[model samples]
Target: MNTRDWNETLRSLNVGLPDDVERLKAAGYYEEAIARIDAYLAEDWTKTQNSPYSQGLCPHMDVQPENPTPHGVDVLRDAMIAQREIMRRIPAEYTWSKADAIAEMQRRVKDFTPEEFEMLDRENRMDWRFVEGEKRYQNRFASTLIATHADLARRQIDPPAQPDSEKERCRRLHEKMAEQGSASARITLKASVGMSDEAFAAALAKAKAEGRDAVHVRAWLPLPAACLSQSDIELEEFTEEPTVIAPENAPQRTVCWEADLTENRSFGVQYSYRNTAVYTDPFDTPSAPEQPDFDTEEQPSHIVFTPYIKALAAQLTAGITDPMEKAKRIYDYVTLNVRYHYQPSYFIHESLPEHCARDRRGDCGIMSVTFITLCRAAGIPARWQSGLYVTPDEVGCHDWAMFYVAPKGWLYADCSFGASMARRGDETLRQHYFGNLDPDRMVANSVFAAPFTPPMLGFRADPCDNQTGEVEADGVGLYGDETVSSKELVQYIEE
Candidate 1:
């Protein structure tokens, strides 16, 4: 629905719905009910502002939030998701006119190199134009953010990404899997953090004297979500017995332990799981799986359909028919065209895909959103899955896309990973991501904007999704406030 419809419906909501249908007699006054919602908790917040789901640029809106008791006000939350989506697609008004664009070059592009100007000209391609103040204006092209802005110069740099050898190996593995159905063994690995080696040794020595391994430490180890690619889930050992173990499929999978410092020398956990790669050739697939959520668009946020997105989709898939092929075209456009760069926090922007399209350079999450948005626009079912990218070397937050094609199941598209190979001119690796993904993934959050098992209070640090687990002590969230966290790949076992 359009933003206007959302606003009108929001303005005209029958806010008087009683908690129980039988209680309607006590809540018949619609105006008073709306006033109560608006003035809820003595705050005169607007409907968009009346949410705790998300903060900054997104609506904390769910059609039905998981409340133990049914609140009569949830109908309003559902409508607000639509309204918030409308707000996201609001055009980039007053960004820049032709004159302003030229002035921006003069100001930001030190020495105004002819080469840079030409690059900017190419990026513009007249994609961004909106009427502003009796004339049309153009937003500046993304070229201004060239690498290494120092000493009044912007030097270009090769795209930074996963190591070349590891990336190529992953692609080759997928190719082998696709051709021969050879499978990668699920790895049994260990993860841990926040303990000194010296302290650990001292505790371990004491535990050994007592014929034990526990040295006493507190640790939170990531627990993997149950996935077709992953199995044999186990948390073999810990410094202390786990006091908090998140559900197997929890949004941010974690198992926490607060063992006495003597119970275990190091705060750590050992677990093992296998990972199998998926490979598909789009043309070989004739249909999509009957998954419930993949068939629909994500809510009134980054993935929302708007006039701008709709037009862009039409332009991108002008003659595409086969769903798999259409999805491929979108993937090609992104991996082939978009530059990979670290982007600022996503919450600062109105829409992620729109931002990526306009700017042309963003990290994995941006590319994932862009791929998902365009694929959905082209009538393909695509969704998001992201978490830690655990290799033998490093573990860091990452995101990727899943487009469904029948017989092939859900195909993985790692545009960022593909873009990395494209930068190195590796055609095989670049194209592999369209229908395959390396098994080096910990799928923590399966869908974007999924709720936590136990809901959090206040705006979560990463409101849209959980990357690492979220933690709170004494009922106060620790993210973006007092606590910082990281995960390391202490071990990687490959068969």
Candidate 2:
């Protein structure tokens, strides 16, 4: 059928009973239960009409009105009466909207094809009595179908239907990072304490251009610890430095959690969009990946990513027609919004959007999720890439996204590292990370919650999604190493 015809058919088919049926009972029209029951059965028929059943012995024999069976009439009668009873059990305010109903419908059935729409239409308009089951059954089937479809849709990310060349492209990039310095070359992170923004920016720019893999940062003046005691320090932006802060007379007591020592570690700070809590994890990577059951129908779509995510993706794509530009948009948005919130590697994979949303902070894992959500919402296919962060100095579990943008195909975007580069005055990280990924990075888990292809020696499964981390060679925690921050390195050297 043409689009117009299809639209009409869909509308007519969806003319089921109102989502809130209690209103019918309130109006003293208890008999309306029959119509509501019929509407639901009609919807089921339309949704499942194209079944590959026998041409002779149809399962829904009553659906064919000319050959009406006494059994079909009894089924519809029983279902209606049961629905009336169900209404009494629930509160009066309960209701599902039309949109909610459609969403519900999609989730209920797998392998539900377009042809079923025609069947449901015919069944509802003609053999309305053929619908079977009681009131409880009616709700169960409908609820199950709707919930399942939503869950499936949430987990499924439709990558652009391109060729397999994307995989090869990623491999080449990995090789580049693999060969960056001597295979055993040690990475050094040097930083300047108490520097101004302009000066820090200039220093970072020099480091970046000279291939001097180091980050430029200023002291968290006063200190990073005062927040625990709720110290009232006036923070001001310094044109020359990172920030000019006036410290209160309160003693500069050290809060174990507040020390900026995390700066010397691999990943930098983390942040979230929904909450105001910030933390730092000293491990190189966040956590190991965890696998979730694939059967559930309710998935993390509307709840995890806020509406602002969609707007951010659109904003990033403005005027930038190139695939690289689109990638840049994705990269920039994440670094700009999500800051570093760190926890122990053991806890990284367990709580994701929950921790990030409630606390408003996360390490790379959270950043990756936020970035992936925005890209998917904008119709850009993105997936997780988790593996050891193999820097020149150390290796630890790290996380990032592989986005498929037009022309560029698939590329990695590491927002945390890219954001650090931006902070240090290197615009290239912000610009290249979107469509262009770092060749220095290697991917471990190409698919989240699934076993890695070709596997690994003694490869262990992730207990949850986004659980990726690393330990020292001796089997201890030490995420990966970030030898890029200048301010952090200065402190490290002094110690």
lDDT of 2 at 162: 43
Which lDDT value does model 2 have at 62?
Answer: 44
- Write candidate 2's Cα lDDT for 1-495 as tens digits: 111111111112112234545456445344565467566544534333444342344475445433334223443434343343333322221233334433444554455444543453343211111112212112233432332234433433342244444334334443443355211112222212232344334445665686755543222211221321122222222213222222222122110111122123332221111101112111223222332222212123211344455465677787754544455566666676554544323211323543443444456767776666666655556766653343333334467766664333345677766665554465643544553444233232444433211111111212222223211111111212311222221111100
Model 2 residue 494 lDDT score: 8
Deviation (Å) of 413 in candidate 1 = 0.9
Quality of model 1 by C-alpha lDDT: 0.59
Candidate 1's TM-score reads 0.60
TM-score of 2: 0.32
Q: Which prediction has the highest lDDT against the true structure?
A: 1
Please provide the root mean square deviation of candidate 1 (C-alpha atoms, Å).
Answer: 13.9
**Candidate 2 segments exceeding 4 Å error:** 1-308, 314-324, 344-360, 437-440, 451-462, 465-495
